[model samples]
Target chain A: MLIDQIKTIINGENVSIALFFIGMYGLCARRNILKTIISMSILQASLVLYFLSLSFHPLNVPPIGADLNAYAYVADPVPQALMITAVVVGISVTAVSLTMFVSMFHKYGTTNWNKVKKKRGEIE
Target chain B: MRRRVLAVLMCIVCFVVIIASNKVPTSDDLPIATYITKNAFAETGASNAVTATYLFYRYYDTLFEALMLLFSIIAVIYMSIHEGDKYDE
Candidate 1:
């Protein structure tokens, strides 16, 4: 009954924080360039989640149409606005990184960082 | 092995620090948010509050964001299409 009262098993913040760590693990432990890109995306998503959660409030209404609901409080617009930029920037970054990775993979025929490094050395 | 262990340790430390540095979130709005809530539509002429805040309140940010998008598109197209040195052929 006590657990039933808890609507969510884990808080959204905790989930995002955990995802942040998982992304970090992928960045640190993995060697593949593509995997690194995926990890970076995970990292971005986690940050987006964190900020959106920071400003999130359910009872608050949208800051529009005062005649519709004059009594309702407006939700904080700052985080939501900022997160839009963040999401776009994240997509842009991922696109750029993928393009770079594609060229590197084409040149080196491998995705592992160490292998790419060795190939570059041989080229020089 | 050592690197993985270090990463786990570092992440755990950061996680604990973040959780400890803040208290639970309150439903009340921050003082700075009052400006956006009260005057967003009046100042920006937009019914959407988020649109007003980003476009008018933080126009500089929007400008830079547009640049970032443009640069990324250019970079992807150039890198993918341009005939550069081919080493693996």
Candidate 2:
């Protein structure tokens, strides 16, 4: 009952925040470069979720009806629209970063951050 | 040992962030959302508010985002091709 009350009050934003923290934990704790990139994408997704939840209302309909008065309570579309751009940017960034990671892995033969550092030191 | 300590620290930081985020301002009272919803169809002739917002109010941003995506793809292709060439030599 208490948890339900908290859920009602916090709603989906809490879940998004939890996802953000989970991604943050992965970023900090993982040693592999690929894992870090995955965590960054997770962080981006959580941010998108947070923005999307902001656009929601309890009884709101999608903001795409011909009869405006009939759908008086439409969710805010600004955040949702902006987040689409952000999502595209996130995808591009992930793609580029993964390419870089693959290049680095090819050069050094390892994905672990510490091992890569050691390899760079040996080369230098 | 250091990883465990860092994990505990990260957990503490996350809890602080969650508590702080609880006080974020509500969006209900914002006039902008109402304005966009009310005027979207009249100005943009699009029933979908999100599409209207993207194509009308923020088309420049969309254009730049497209450019960015294209540039990043080009960079990836260029980098990979040069790396491949290096292996052949």
Candidate 3:
């Protein structure tokens, strides 16, 4: 029952809202660039979960070959199609952001944003 | 000191608001479990709805996402390695 409840929650809008807040918390709370990147990844995963949940329909047979008329449910294909694109884009964005974080760490010798900013000012 | 106290009070109020809003679900809300179970297999060819949603319909997106994660790892490693080389020089 708990699993079912969780499934329901994921399928609904709450997961997306939760992820958005959590991601914001990570971005705002963490001083380390790596943690921020990890948080961003988590945020992206939330969206993936949200989109994937939309494709479900109870008691439906796989779309391979079934009695369409007798079937009690039909799956939503559009969300599934859209989620694939979201996953890929999320990955690319995470990759680029992390790359920038790593480069910043290298240049400043510290991952803390405040220190990095100070160091950049010194360099200029 | 006044600003710090105000900030703490604000944080507590926000926390309380979030907690209060998460009430028990009513019966009228849509039964997502039933919906998922009914449509999952018929819409996507996967037995598992989660798998079907992620791998089948969104396979290309998943593929690119994995690639992007790989790219991040590579970039981090590259930057660190380059930083080390610069130190040696």
Which one wins on lDDT?
A: 2
The RMSD of every model to the true structure, in order and in angstroms, is 4.1, 2.8, 7.6
lDDT of each: 0.81, 0.83, 0.63
Q: Taking chain A of candidate 3, what TM-score results?
A: 0.75
For residues B1-89, could you state the per-residue lDDT of candidate 3 as single tens digits?
66545645554565456545857654442355345545667776566565665676457767767776787677656555553365543
Sorted into a CAPRI-style docking class, model 1 comes out as medium
Rank the candidate models, highest DockQ first.
2, 1, 3
Q: Which one wins by TM-score: 1 or 3? A: 1
Model 2, span A1-124: residue lDDT tens: 9999877767678778888888888887889898899999999999999989875778988888655656658788789878989999999999999999988877889989988988879644
Give the clashing pairs for model 1.
none
Q: Which stretches of candidate 3 lie over 4 Å from their true place?
A: A1-12, A55-57, A66-70, A122-124, B1-89
Cα lDDT tens digits, model 2, B1-89, are: 79967986986787677767788677566577788888888887888888988888889988999999999999788666644365543
Question: What ordering of candidates by lDDT runs from best to worst?
Answer: 2, 1, 3
Q: Write the per-residue lDDT of candidate 1 for residues A1-124, one digit (tens) a residue.
A: 8787555536778779989988998999889899999999999999999887766656777666433235466677888889999999999999999999988877889999988888778643
Give each prediction's DockQ, rounded to 2 decimals: 0.57, 0.65, 0.15
Off by over 4 Å in 2: A122-124, B24-27, B82-89
Off by over 4 Å in 1: A1-9, A67-69, A122-124, B24-29, B82-89
Least accurate 10 contiguous residues by lDDT in model 3 chain B: B25-34
Residue-pair clashes, model 2? 0
Task: Report the poorest 10 consecutive residues by lDDT, candidate 1 chain B.
Answer: B80-89
